[model samples]
Target: MAVFLTLVLGSLAARATLADTWPAAIACGLALMFTLTGIAHFVPGMRRDMIAIVPPPLPAPALLVTVTGVLELMGAVGVVYPPTRADAAGCLFVLMLAMFPANIYAARMPDPPASMTANLGLRSAEEAVYLAAAIVVAVRGGQ
Candidate 1:
């Protein structure tokens, strides 16, 4: 939210072209979020929780999470480049979908904290919003 607002405000302040501002802002906001969450993969407790949530089918859970983190950061970089923005958004859209099983698995776990259970719902909504943003960015990137 902050990233989106900042992008919108910055675009307005700079008097950016209408066609570019809106879509660029959406892509940039998601980029910021992806970067932050990718960084979160390194924090101990968060990292443990992240590793815990991986669905069993994917091999090398820890490595996978690390790789995703790297990809998120790379996507963040790609999103800022007009030429690669659509491709980045598409990859991220798929990334979000790929991560859904972890959210579902976490939601089903009998964690003692109620907040933990609810977090999955919140994440699901967030992922949906991001996915939508990605779609918008992809479409607008070609314009």
Candidate 2:
């Protein structure tokens, strides 16, 4: 819900202040969304929730969270840069795919963290929306 709202509101703000084109607005939205989420990785509560969601099989969950957070931050920067927008969007799409298993793991856990407890179906739908938005930014944002 936060991601969707950020994208929509950010797009509107971008349209007003950044560019009038949908591609540009969407790119700005993606960048804003990523920036917010990326920062959440370092916040104590959110970081704990993020780490808790990582599949147990993946060693160094904390490190993985940190690394992915950094990647998200970098992607946020890249997505708004004209030269790197499409490439960044593509990478973010792949990143979303890569991170989904953790969401599944969290959903299946008997007692998931409160922050990560969205049901599998809802989480999947959210992921689909995010992926679709990323695709839109990737395919047309370069313009």
Candidate 3:
């Protein structure tokens, strides 16, 4: 969720502000994406899957998982406003970093689920791309 949000937000922020720089489209896409995934947080089956990914170091895994979904909702809303885009992207970037361990832990699980990002390499690439995109969005959004 964080990676996808940051990637879309950053991609928009990287472009020029003078024209229709595609930020609006990307942001909208991200908003939609997060909305679906956020909803998934509440689904019992999905929640179980999420529980499997929670890192032990985190004190409140369940709460942390729930809060992340809420944050994604907030990020989706924040990315829609031009004045808030940069800050939203920056925050999303940090969120991605924070949640990365979950990806790592999940990858290490035996018979890790059959998701496209179930492996360490794929998850790492996903985070890397998202981080770059977030940087671009933050840098170009204000221009």
Give one digit per residue, the lDDT tens place, for model 3 in 1-143: 45465446554554344236665555554555556667777777777778768878778778887999899778877766888987887887788788888888888887665542676887797678666656666677545
Off by over 4 Å in 1: 1-20, 112-120
Greater-TM-score candidate between 1 and 2: 2
Which residue pairs in candidate 3 have backbone atoms (N, alpha carbon, C) closer than 3 angstroms, thus clashing? 10-133, 13-137
Candidate 2, residues 27-107: lDDT per residue as tens digits? 899899999999999999999999999999999999999999999999999999999999999999999999999999998
Order of the predicted models by TM-score, top scorer first: 2, 1, 3
Tens-digit lDDT track of model 1 for 36-138: 7788777777777788878777899899889888888888788878899999988988988887888788887777223234466666766677778789888
Winner on TM-score (1 vs 3): 1
Q: What TM-score fits each model?
A: 0.80, 0.94, 0.78
Task: Give the count of colliding residue pairs in each prediction.
Answer: 0, 0, 2
